[model samples]
Target: MSNLNKLDFTTLEVSGRNYLKWVQDVKLYFTAKSLKATIEELIDNEPANEAKKATAMIFIQRHIYDAPQTEYLPEEDPRTFWLALADHFNHQKDIHLLEARHDWQRLCFQDFKSLNEYNSEVCRI
Candidate 1:
């Protein structure tokens, strides 16, 4: 509980622009807390303890932006909540990938006023 105050990463945003990085951060944090099993799809043998699931729920609630937090407030199982979030964010990630691809396809050196500007856009894409 004391470590909850030390949020080492940005909260998951409703816009999901940072979803990929947020997923990575969440996985690392869960692993560190031995709560990874609460979010995993398969169990080796035994189910995750209720206390661990509750702790995971609290951690997820704390690390997400307010809109999603409210939307998922009724959720009781951490694994189910985690899957729902993953489904939404995976779609978001695909949309961003398509947009980036479109931008890359349309990119042209002559479209920019300066070489640096074109380079910057390329880097961004």
Candidate 2:
């Protein structure tokens, strides 16, 4: 069933119109500060390990570039909405270009098998 085919636009179900709004708002928020500050904020509120900060940050970037693609990430994926916005911070506060750059980088990678391998390698458990 198509999401739009549903009657109610509310109830944690983000409307397509509202989804665009959220994306726009996110872009605005990220650009209000420097990328470094954005990164710091994401790291500040989220789980982190000493050596995994950069990769975690990258994961955040990919998730935000396309929310649909990242929606299914498990709790331990290290990627989150806030992190993606942080990567968009810039002087002029224009997030489109920065988001595009992140999108480009994200698209370059090949898909992986599963999260278990990621957990074994990254978390060393």
Q: State every prediction's TM-score relative to the real structure.
A: 0.83, 0.23
lDDT of each: 0.89, 0.41
Tell me the TM-score of model 1: 0.83
lDDT of 1 by residue, 44-117 (tens): 67789999999999888888889998887788999999998998787877888899999989999999999999
On a 0 to 100 scale, what is the lDDT of residue 86 in model 1? 90
Error of 2 at 71 (Å): 4.0
Which lDDT tens digits does candidate 2 get at residues 1-125? 67534422121122232334444543454455323333344554654553454544453344333453355344343334344333333222344557656655654223547766554444331
Q: How accurate is candidate 2 locally (lDDT)?
A: 0.41
